[model samples]
Target chain A: MRFVLALLATLLVGTALGLAATRWTASNRQGFSAEQAGPWIAWPKAGTSEAEPYARAFQARTGYVPLGGGDGVALFALSDSDGRPLEGNCAYDVGGAVPAARFWTLEAFSPRGRPVAGPLGRLGFTSAEVMHDAAGHFMVAVSPQVRPGNWLQVATPGRFVLVLRLYETVLSASAFSLEADALPAITRGACR
Target chain B: MIFALPFFLGAVLIAVMVHLASLLALPGFATNDAYARLGRNAPIDQVAALTQAQIAALDLPFYDRSFETAVCKYDLSAGVLRLRAPSPDTMLLVTLIARGGNVYFSVSDRAAIKGLVEVLVGTDAQIEQIEASDKDDEVLGELRVRAPKPQGVALIRVFAPDETSKARAAEEAAQASCQIETL
Candidate 1:
């Protein structure tokens, strides 16, 4: 009788432990496939067949339609360069050079993945239109109020995400070894 | 609760198997996978550009909002899929995704030999049948990809680097066409 009880306990424990680990990985599995650059993280294998089992499982669970597969990779930032969680009220500066891609884009989204468009219908900036300093460095001001230079207006409230997609770049072949300086940085300004 | 050390070891073994098994099986049972979500609005063999509002409604995690995208869900069980899109510009990309969301093949506009990007996707047997029926080299002008699955989706992305090109990008994205022929 004791052996049967112990066997049942083992089965229950094993099932719970296994399922919990799976759940945890479904949310936190990027540790293996992701490469970090400053505050941004990109899963170089998110949409490819080379993606691992955990990555595939995560995609299935999240239904993330990755930026497709060829000629591009998307990096997302949930926090500032200093590692502070990004809030809607906080102003920020995205400044620096992205890796050499034929094209790239920058946009902010609500945590739920909706575009954070302002009343003026301002949502994001494309590589060709963003302004640059005299030294040829690019800077994008992320704020709700009006600002000078390139402005990526954030209109929604609560937590948000910044997605930087580099298309037709060499990173698609070497994302596993991307340098920290290859991408831009998110610096917090003032919070309203 | 005191338990035997052997039982604990056995539990660990079972746990490992359970974890691996779940990873392999989750996609099959995932109710909200990309295929399911894309199918919610994308009808079979029809290219539909994903609107920002529709994309928001889908609530995909970490989707890029700057790029214009179109999708065509296809079922090869019935016939062959002939996908064609204009590549008048340089920033177009097409990805063929299997049902479980694995991108089996990817191509860029640079490969568009005739300024018209065309491809034929079919299963192995279906391709053989197509080759036998086409008679000439009609399907040779573009890519011929033998799909590993009977059902999948094709994604078309157009990059708009600024406001000047945003309207053009949306127009290009909407031009993708997917047609299924029994031959």
Candidate 2:
């Protein structure tokens, strides 16, 4: 009976710790601000829609607007492929878990949230088609080089932003988990 | 008694885990509800039909943020449509757009102004008004700016973003895009 009690206590403690750890992880992830986190993070601002206000303000300030259209206004979050603060001119692999929805996309943006203009396309990628990794994680590569995988090549060296979008996430069961530490971090050979 | 100790410990552990998971998922759920409800106050036609076109042309994704549904309330007396997502917890976007361009946008939170302006005017044009309205029967939003006609007269009555008004704004944006001068 003493042995049984000890075993139960051990399991109980383990489970409790696991639960507490999850909360601690979330809190820790949200601690870093844009300045501390290298300016790649963007949370939804005030408005009926997410990312619209920021995108609009960015366009108004910079004279550049996010791509796609108003109907499918895409909202993206920037992170490294390895889940860390993003750096400029570094190679990064992007991937995430997306739930079942109408459509979703990932695109590369300049640090200022504008799509990076490059030979690869329009400085971003849309959901029409995306390559996945061996683990079924939606994967895209972001770098100055044009290699395999979902590549977002930067012609010039500068800070960049990645926008992961779920156009109609309103109807989906999945939710986004975007925090500073959770983002994939990639330091390209050039930056490294 | 020893077995009871283990059971108690196990129960505590389960409780802790449940609390943590809820903490992670709660805010997201709230934000999602707010977003979905905000979109509701407007006519479903404004956003729903664009699912296909928006996805293909705009590269928009239907992210797994929350459940999406269109909500609407028809005002029988006022004969107007009230639709919105649940962000500010007050007026919806459709109310703003439906109120028309000549309306005065009033908001107390300056932080919300930048965002509110974007929603009001598809273009993030600089807002050029700052004054208090004497009319007690006015609505409260972030920043209340009076729309001016060509002659600079403030329009007294403002309408929301009805289908026609939304279409007009879109057309104007498209036209402006085409007319941009290339250096």
Best by TM-score: 1
Residues A55-127 of candidate 2 have per-residue lDDT tens digits of 2222222222122222122334444434455555677655555544344555565554445647745445545
The best candidate by DockQ is: 1
For A18-118, candidate 1 gives per-residue lDDT tens digits of 98888788755642667787899888877676777887888777777665456678888999999998888888999887887887778888765677878
> Could you tell me the TM-score of chain B in model 1?
0.90
DockQ of each: 0.62, 0.06
lDDT of 1 at A157: 74
lDDT of 2 by residue, B125-180 (tens): 22321123235676555332222211110101111122223333332222210011
- Candidates' TM-scores? 0.88, 0.36
Off by over 4 Å in 2: A1-42, A49-85, A133-135, A170-192, B1-183
lDDT of 1 by residue, B42-91 (tens): 88999998876787687767665566788999999889999998994548
lDDT of 1 at B155: 82
RMSD of each: 2.9, 18.5
